[model samples]
Target: MHFVTGGSFHGKAKWVQEHYSASRVAEGWFNGYEDASWETRDFTTSLVVLEGLEQLVKKVVEENVIGGRAALRGKLKLWLDWEASEPDRRLVLIGTDIGKGIVPLEKENRLWRDVTGWFYQDVVMAAERADVIWYGLPQALK
Candidate 1:
């Protein structure tokens, strides 16, 4: 269970793919006050989202006291339920356009930045034991 995220074109996914070749990355949903979707949400939202996921994971691990395939399945169901309830949790979010500094707008642009930022925060939390990749440079950020 790893979450890879970063600003647009930051190569987060590529890095993950390179490492976890067999891992599956899925897209999630968004629930924000603004119409720009991910653009306006704040970092706190990302933190909450990640915290929710961690809680869910803990629940799964606890339920899987027996430690078997059945328990794993049950834990997976827990994750599915969480995703159904919170679409945002289902996403492998990425921000591909934030190198030029903040955009000059108050609607979609801002929303995108905020959302991307928050998403990245969540990814960091979820993938706490993550490795940061920049310009082909990889660094551990746990």
Candidate 2:
């Protein structure tokens, strides 16, 4: 699994697509300033937490299963329950507009930026590898 994240209009998704040809990508946008009603920070954090949990479940299931007919019934129930709880299993996550920058005027906006930046950091820590793209150049941060 690969997680690509960057600031606004940084082309994180494009880089991932170019390298991996990801068949599926899940995007989470925390529009902090635009919508006042939504808890964008909390939502983004939940999404990242869910992503890590789902990945762990996948690894567990993959490890338990072996081969043909027996594999189907071996750990199917355990895996099924886990899968049902979290259904969005994305192979790749392209998170855009998440970065650290100037402070916002509103509390929610400030919270959103801080949370998004933290979320990105958490993702990078959990990921096997992470890359930062700047000026059309890729640098491995982890």
Candidate 3:
């Protein structure tokens, strides 16, 4: 599994596409920005890209998932298992760096940021490769 993160509109999707242009021929991309329903997505392709992680986290916060991080971790574990089930399969997670900038004025927004930050940390720790993009440039973190 590979994790890619960066600020909003920082070219994260572009970088991931170029980085995996070869394997992307048969990739499945779940654009969470438009719809954060990845929990119900079924993957048939070897390369699965989950973009707009921040929005998904926001959804989680809005829904008030019980156990919060623990529950999210369990959900992530399911994807990890899916990736491990297929030797040739790849899972790429693209999240915006919402932890930066000024703190949110609203409590819900703050919770979203906090949970997203923690989620990113967990993914980075578990991912085989981690990268952070800045101004369309990528820097390897793992």
Give Cα-based local distance difference scores for all models. Answer: 0.40, 0.43, 0.87
Model 3, C-alpha of 47: deviation from truth (Å): 0.3
Off by over 4 Å in 1: 6-10, 23-100
Preferred candidate (TM-score higher): 1 or 2: 2
- Give the per-residue lDDT of model 3 (tens digit) for 11-92: 9998988888833334498888888997667898888999898888888778875567886788799999999998999999
Ordering by TM-score: 3, 2, 1
Q: Against the hidden true structure, what lDDT does model 2 obtain?
A: 0.43
In the range 1-142, model 1's lDDT, one tens digit per residue, is 3454334446655665455442322222332211223322333221222212222323333444334334434433444344456545433332233434757575544544444444345545644255555665556766
Clashes of each: 12, 0, 0
Question: What TM-score number comes out for model 1?
Answer: 0.40
